[model samples]
Target: MPELLIDIPSTFVERIERLAAEENESLEDMAMLLLRRGYDFAVTRPEVEPDRSQRPGARSDARLDWWREARFGLFIHWGLYSVPAGVWKGRDWPGIAEWLMYRAEIPVQEYEKLAAQFNPVKFDAKAWVSLAKRAGQKYLVITSKHHDGFCLFDSAVTDYDMVDATPFKRDVLKELAEACAAQGIKLGFYYSQTQDWHHPDGDGNDWDFDPAEKDFAGYIEDYVKPHVRELLTNYGPIGIIWFDTPKGISEEQSRSLLALCNELQPDCLVCGRLGNALGDYATAGDNRIPEEVLDLDWETPATINDSWSYKINDHNWKSSVDLIRKLVDIVSKGGNYLLNVGPTGEGVIPQPNVERLEAMGRWLEVNGEAVYGTQPGPIQGRADLRTTSKEGVIYLHVFDWPADGQIRVEGVAAQGARLLAGGAALPVEVSSGALVISVPEEAPDEAATVIALR
Candidate 1:
């Protein structure tokens, strides 16, 4: 199917204006609300079939299968803010790098000045992809464009891009895209849909619900659309469009943006933050993991520390064990876990983040079978423990060890059982009620032991 150019019809605009007047909301706010609804409609309607020609190497089923199997991914929050590298002047900034301008209340002009000094001399895209792979991550989502409004790629749409405006003068997105393709890691772009503080039209003071901005619709047509086109077309194959901040967009605008993305990159997955259901997957905000699988494909994105971008004084980092457990829990609940890493100003990932990822990787080396290529178990019970299955093989991830060497697994119909990490076969005896298995005196893994059922 060809790309459908989304132009808000005049009648729909009139209805929205009337609704806004009735609700005492600005026209922009009403439009945004409507767009949100439309997005939900698009996501839920299922009227639009996926374009098969655009999705390369796999059918829709295969892509969905691969996505379901890939329960873990690495999210990098790096950009011009990385040049500040978590510090303002000689003082350590405790906030995320991306929000440095907002936290410091530095005007956009002053923040753009950092572009002159934003040269990532040691920035290696291959190394970044390699790190993610080593961490046992199947996909990589980087900020192609953040709320700060700087484009990582050479955008024909704007002069305020990495290759054109910054000292780095490199197309980071192109490099990363190539690296991801080479490494067989799915590449995703994090594009902020609404707040582009740098762009004149993106000025939050006007368009956001707080203050009315003039000609907001014009901004979307001229600036946002062109940049999005650049992202979808210039990049070889973007796996996902991770949109954020749908503040002032109309429902029609949101639908148009999503439709355009699908038209350009038909197989590409879109996130829930597009202010509507125009996305393939739902996104749970920072550090939020839903207790139940959201009845839709979803991913929980969380930072190692409080900040998405590197912060000099933010020593708070999640332990390797905790991170691994989070991954296991998320997968067992049938969701993807996206762990974030904020790189320092000099373009190097902080040592702490690297160490944590490496430690998780070490654990993954042994118990990864329980993780990758597995689906959620049928039985959702078992406190502190979860199960995943593949090829009729059930993996019981024991979060809490039993005092005696026995753990009761209800509804396990498998005839044989073994330890995945240790490879030690266990005696499985079925009682009148449930199947009981004798675990080893010591657990195979300190965090979680995988009991493989055959």
Candidate 2:
């Protein structure tokens, strides 16, 4: 957990290459082995314990408190790939922005050319955090590094990062951290574990692979871990280290990484993608929310559109009402919803994405009371409806309102009821062991109607 900058010896790289050939292992495997040894050594080596000031709370217990309370967050997937803005050469790329190179099978050198022109002149950290705050997002998770292997932050470990390589030389992560601090939004970093095909050690394919020439494991030790240390130490109190791609990581290595985070900032949260349960919360990928999330902490990440990164031709963005419904649905099921927004290459979130968020913000302005501080219901209701509770009051969110001004809800024996939208006293009576209430002639909102019960 030392904040010292990593300095790898030139001979170390040669040794790694030699070791890989001797073991008949791929460079990636050798890199993992070296990293495992380095991390193990770092953790076990004795050093003077620094001042305990600003240290985080117990990892196991502190995170649960935050997890249960944070019902909604904003997931941002912006990077150099956004600069391509979903276009390769002169034609439009069909896949996501991050995958523009891979999907198009563009040569690494060709994709690297985009980096020279990558400049987010309109990038405004304050504006970005303000949007998330207005949308009622309690936390913000930005992609610090994606599968493309480009680092968003300024890492001394490599020149292939945002600060040194791209035209936009500012530390995006640093500015974001400052903005989140100013706005009181918890900040988290999403780090992809897999290296990109563009890097030197990452050039091999599944077929006709050779391990002698490339030292993949050395890259992990010399590049990845050191960069992670820099991130944890430099970024003032990152709330979470959201790791991705545990494909090559071993349980021991994962545990060591988690331990490093805990040692550096004990309160920092980690996600389930870190190989073992080393992560504090379980993550459900895009649009794949669980019907019954486990009793433990969990979150579901989904995009407003089909892709995580902005796609010009991708017109499948979810409406504000749909996004709000999804948020309510997830919260009612005891989970946090991390809705994603992909900004264009010039550092502007598309007009459609901004419009949807604004609309959702308006709805939240009125209905946030039932969401912000509420806990999940004791019993999940029917498919068309959901429930959340605050104090002794239960709020039933009816997704599909019944016609004929009558709605029947089971399992809740309520003594009194009221309409949350209008605050009008509702007449509730029990019949045949079910609670029946009179619905308004028309729905308060086209999306869903919330009824408060005590």
Candidate 3:
């Protein structure tokens, strides 16, 4: 026996081992055979490779105009982990629900059993999209697949999907796609490309799979590429492909995935986590906002509560005021806000989550112009305040309340000033080389108030 190490999931080695055992051959011979077989599964390849010989992670910059303006979106993390809801074997798990498999180190045999009881009768795709629309989210990005290796959509590459393995046979992705289209919302898919825990050839689950079983090339050819193709072809007009937690993939492999996406859908936006920093835009640290402005295109994936996925013990919900301020801060710093909501196993967005979203939507109803289609404020590094400008007009976001009726804006000479929520003009004057506006006795909005200046 020879040691065969690979960069792919541990399970891929098991697959090659099984192949070797079935043929009564050595591991080295099986490795070669696996690579040969992988080289041949070119079904996902386009008949004619487009003339897109651009560098790895290359993308069409002009195609993301809509994405640039879509300052807010909803990120949903739903899968079998919701079934466990963070409780495994009657013991409470602390982290996010989606990481149940990896964190708990549960074997694939035992973890797959979760599908038997997975039923989301309350899951309504239409309602989900409708809520997003009302919440002022320009798009919706849901977890098509998470690290647990469970597929929420119907994947031909594997039968361990919502339509096949789970009791709920409905395809969640299909309904979401249809609903998003009907509601005029852009839809994107979040996939855990390198961290699938379910498929025998998928990555992660080192406890169940040996080192030799991890075949990066084999998994890429047999599973990853095909899954991307299925999502691209089966779903109509995907806005973006969000690949997360890049660990096992190489730079060349990452580039190949990017090229494949560019080939299939030239205009599709790819997130930076696809590995090797090869993506259309940048992804920020989880649930965090950048204090200073970023020169490159970036986005912050935030949570309505503390956890990205459903957690029964996690009640640290961000207030409507807090979320509004956070969104303003992100957009002010030249970044998009990707807020998350984790539905329960029963398929319902927590009531608290819905209420907070609706509140933000209500605020947007009055102050959308201040957010949408705006650029970074002329002034930078204002913690208590932010500015977004379009054309000659600038909107000042007052995150804190002034106990007095007077407010001052530095580094700006205001030609005029008015309340954004209402069309009321406020007296403005430049004093001490700063723009000052006269506000009311109290803050107009509990979250933040926007003032327009010309």
Candidate 4:
């Protein structure tokens, strides 16, 4: 008999051996059983090549055309942290709800207890995807694994996942993937590559593990890489692998992760947080937009409220008017708006979040032409006014409707002007190298009113 060798992470090998014993089968037969369950032993290229080439120490634009044109997307941050909802031992932590573990410095054994009670019976994949679609989001990104190191999908590498550990026993990511496909929305995963508080060797667990003795490289090889591989392999086609908190990740480690994404799903985009400026696009700070237009492709990830994860007391929701205006501002500055929602532990999006999204959807139904597939307009540096352009037409987004019924747009030569909401032409005149247009005394929409000029 000849011997065949397969090199994989030790964790997977242990899983296979354990299964072999439980099933009363040979090791090879157990390996075959695992393979039959859709386990990919090796990385293989898909039929189509990536859109852009990747070079060492350089970021590749690879398949971001749809992302750039999308203009807006949905970000979901759901995990065990949602179960706590930002209160630890009856004390409400005041910050991002997801950082409850790190902020309070809870013990691993105690924090892991949340898994026993983690059951989101109300989670509806179809409904979630439909909401994103209704909100005019072209793509969706969910946190597959956050800093707490909780896994939302079934992993052969570990059992501390939604399926095995939690009472829900359902793979949330799998359901979301199917729903996204059915709804025609691109899917992306947010994985915390560097910070895994649960694991002893993983970064950000100083309370449990001695940092001096921890083998960070070993953790990357055994845990992080395996999880990333599992994500790319199990999912049908991932749009983006959004990594967060690079902290102490080495340049070599970042490149290695990039190589894995390239090898498995070349079309999948790697965001800048993967570290060392090797992402297809740059990501702005949380809830922070750039002051000026960045030369490279960038996106601003913002929360619907102040918290990224669900917080019972965090009622400070941004108004629909402010959110709509924020969307216009980001697009005008040549960036994508990744609006986030923190669903309750019961799997229901807070009603306020739903209402805001619906309102934005209604706003988009009439003014989508001004937003979708548009470029940053020629006009810049105005707080009350922002602009987006498609083809030769420019869209003037008036956040603060001029009460005087007259507005002046600089550096534009307009032959005609009309309201996008009503298609009613307005009077226009040229004066002092600017186009002055007459408007209604009252704005049609409270959020933002658009004027199309050509």
User: Which tens-of-lDDT digit does each residue in 326-442 have in candidate 1?
Assistant: 898888877888899987657788889999998888888888888888878765756768888888888888888888988887777878899878688999898877789988788
Candidate 4 worst ten-residue window by lDDT: 45-54
Model 2 error, position 370 (Å):
2.1
Error of 4 at 114 (Å): 0.5
Q: What is the C-alpha lDDT of each candidate?
A: 0.77, 0.77, 0.84, 0.87
Candidate 2 local Cα displacement, residue 344, angstroms: 1.2
Which stretches of model 4 miss by more than 4 angstroms?
Answer: 1-62
Residue 92, model 1: Cα distance from true site in angstroms: 5.0
lDDT by residue for model 3 (97-200), tens: 78878777789999999999999999999999999999999999999988888888898878989999988999999999999999999999998888877766
By lDDT, the best candidate is: 4
Give candidate 2's whole-model lDDT: 0.77
Model 2 lowest lDDT segment of ten? 46-55
Tell me the tens digit of each residue's lDDT in model 4 across 1-454.
7777655545457768988999999988888777766645222322111221123433235377888889899999999999999999998887899999888878899999999989999999999999999999999999999999999999999989999999999999999999999999999999999999998888987767778988889989899999999999998999999998887888899889999999999899888788876777777767767666656677788998999989999999999999998898888887889999999988999999999998998999999988888888998888888899999999999888887898898889889999999899999999888899999999988888999999
Task: Give the Å error, residue 271, model 3.
Answer: 0.8
> Can you give the TM-score per candidate against the true fold?
0.83, 0.83, 0.86, 0.86
Q: To one decimal, what is the Cα RMSD in angstroms of model 3 from the true structure?
A: 10.2
Provide backbone clash counts, one per model.
Answer: 5, 7, 6, 0
Better of 3 and 4 by lDDT: 4
lDDT of 2 by residue, 41-84 (tens): 76653221111101133234655676567788889998778877
